[model samples]
Target chain A: MIQVAVCGPRDASEAERAQAREVGRLLAGRGAVVVCGGYGGVMEAVAAGASGAGGLVVGVLSLSTREGANPHLTVAIPTGIGEARNAAVVNAGDAVIVVGGSWGTLSELALALRSGKRVVQLGGWRIADAEGAPLDGITRAGSPAEAVAATGLFV
Target chain B: MIQVAVCGPRDASEAERAQAREVGRLLAGRGAVVVCGGYGGVMEAVAAGASGAGGLVVGVLSLSTREGANPHLTVAIPTGIGEARNAAVVNAGDAVIVVGGSWGTLSELALALRSGKRVVQLGGWRIADAEGAPLDGITRAGSPAEAVAATGLFV
Candidate 1:
C-alpha cells in the first residue's frame, strides 16, 4: 500500500485542522496508509479521519512510550526521539502532504524534499532563498482534493 | 560527556571538509562525544578527526548495515531508515554544528532548530521568509573554532 505522510503543526488552526482531516479522509478513500507525527492537532485530526474511513493510520510518535499518541492510530511507533521523529514520519511516506506550517512541520518538509520525495503543500508557511526566490520542488494546492491529486500516486 | 552533532553535505568542498575535521577535533579535545551522519565527505572528515584525537565518535547511519559507514567511527548505528536517520543524528547531539550546505544538511539544520537544540553554522545555505527576512535561531560562525564555541557546550 502507498504511504502518504501528512504533516502539520501541533498547535494548528481550526481551518488547518479541517483541511488535515479532509486530506486524511481523501487519502484513506484512495486506499493509502496515512503516516503522521501521531500527537495532537493536525496529527490527531488526520488519524481520526483515516480511522473513520476504516483505513490504516500509522503514528510515528516522538515519545518512547505510547502515552500521548492519538487514539485513532492503528499502529503507534514510539520513537522516543523527541522531535527527531519528524524525520521518520516523512521517511515512512512514499509521498508527503503538508497541511499547516510550524518549525517541526518545516523540518519534515525539508527532509522530504531532501530525499527527493513528491511533496504537496496545503495552507502553510513559505520558504525562500536568501534572495527571496521560492525554493523549487514543492507543489501548492488550494484544497485537500488538490493536495492528494498533486501527490501523483493515485493518478 | 556532551554529544555534538556535526552535519554537512556528502559532496563537500575541501574547505568544508577541513572545517568539519577541525570542528570534530576541537569537540573531541574538549572531551565531547562526536555524532555524525557516518558516510563520506564531511562525515568522514569529522569522524577521522575525532578518532585521531582518541575521542569517541558515533555514526548514525541511514543504511541498516554498516557497509558504507566511515572507518573512524567508534560505534555504528545502522538505522536503515534512509534520510530519516538524520533525525537520530541530531537527537543524539546536545547541540548541532553545520559545516556546509546541501538538501540533506538543510534538513538536519531545520530539525535541530525545531527541537530547540543550539545550532551553529559554518558555511551553508540560508533560509528566509518569503519576503527575504532571515529566520532566527541559527548562530553563524566564521571558523571551526567559532562554531564549536557557539555551541556553548564547552563553556
Candidate 2:
C-alpha cells in the first residue's frame, strides 16, 4: 500500500486540525496508509480520521514505547529518538502532505524535499531564502482535497 | 562521554570539509563522541578527523548494511531507514553542529532546534521568515573552534 506521511504541529489551530482530518479520511478512502508523528494535535486528528474510515494508520512515535501514542494508530513504531523521528515520518511516505507548520514540521518538509519526495503544503508557515525568495520545492494547496491531489499518487 | 552530532551535505566545498574535520578533531580532543551521517564529503571528513584523534566516531548509516560507511568510524549502525536516519543522527547527540547547508543539513538543523538542543552553524545556508527576518535559535560561529565552543558541551 502507498504510505503517505502527513506532517503538522502538535499545537495546531482548529482549521489545520480539520484539514488534517479530512486529508486522512480521503487518503484512507483511496486505500493509502496514513503515517504521522503519533502524538497529539494534527497527528491525532489525522489518525482519527483514517481510523474512522477503517484505514491503516501507522504512528512513527518518538518515544521508545507506545506510552503516549494516539489510539487511532493501527501500528505504532516507537523510535525513542525524540524530534529526530521527524525524519523517519517523512522518509516513510512515498509522498508528504503537510497540514501546518512548526519547527518539527519544517524539518520533515526539508527532509522530504532533500530526499526528492513530492511534498504538498496546506496551511503552514512560509519558508524563504536569506533574500526572502521562496524556496522552490513544495507545492501549496488550498484545501485537504487539493493537498491530497497535489501528492499525485492517486492519479 | 557527550555525543555531538555533526551535520553537513555529502556534496560539500573544500572549506566546509576542512571545517568539519577540525570540528571533529576538537570534539574528539575534548573526549566527546562524534556522530555523523556516515557517507561522503563532510561526514567522511569528520569521521577521519575524529578517528585520527583516537576518538570514537559513530556513523549512523541510512543503509541496512555498512555498504558505503566511511572507514574512520569506530561504530556503524545501518538503520535501513534511508533519509529517516537523519533524525537518528541528531537524536543521538546532546548538541548538533552544522558545517554547511543542503536540504538534508537544513532538516537536521531544524530538528535539533525543535528538540531544544543547542545548535551551532559553521558555514551554512541561512533561514529567514517570509518577511526577511532571520529566525532565532541558531548560534552562528565563524570557525570550527568557535562552532565547537558554541555547542556549550565542552564547557
Real A-B contacts recovered, model 1: 0.52
The worst-scoring run of ten residues by lDDT in candidate 1 chain B lies at B125-134
Question: Taking the tens digit of each residue's C-alpha lDDT, what string does model 2 give over A1-155?
Answer: 89999999899889888999999999999999999999989999999999999999999998999998989999999988777677788879999999877778889989889889999988776775434467798898999999999999999
Encode model 1's per-residue lDDT on B1-155: one tens digit a residue: 78999999899989889998999899989999999999999999999998899889999999999998999999999998878788889889999999877778888888888879999988777776434467789999999999999998877
Chain A only: TM-score per candidate: 0.98, 0.98
Global CA lDDT computed for model 2: 0.89
List TM-scores of chain B, every candidate: 0.98, 0.98
Tell me each candidate's TM-score. 0.83, 0.83
**lDDT values for all models:** 0.89, 0.89
DockQ of each: 0.40, 0.44
Residue pairs with backbone overlap in model 1:
A64-A80
Q: What alpha-carbon RMSD in Å does predicted model 2 have with respect to the real structure?
A: 3.1
What's the C-alpha lDDT at position B132 in model 2? 45
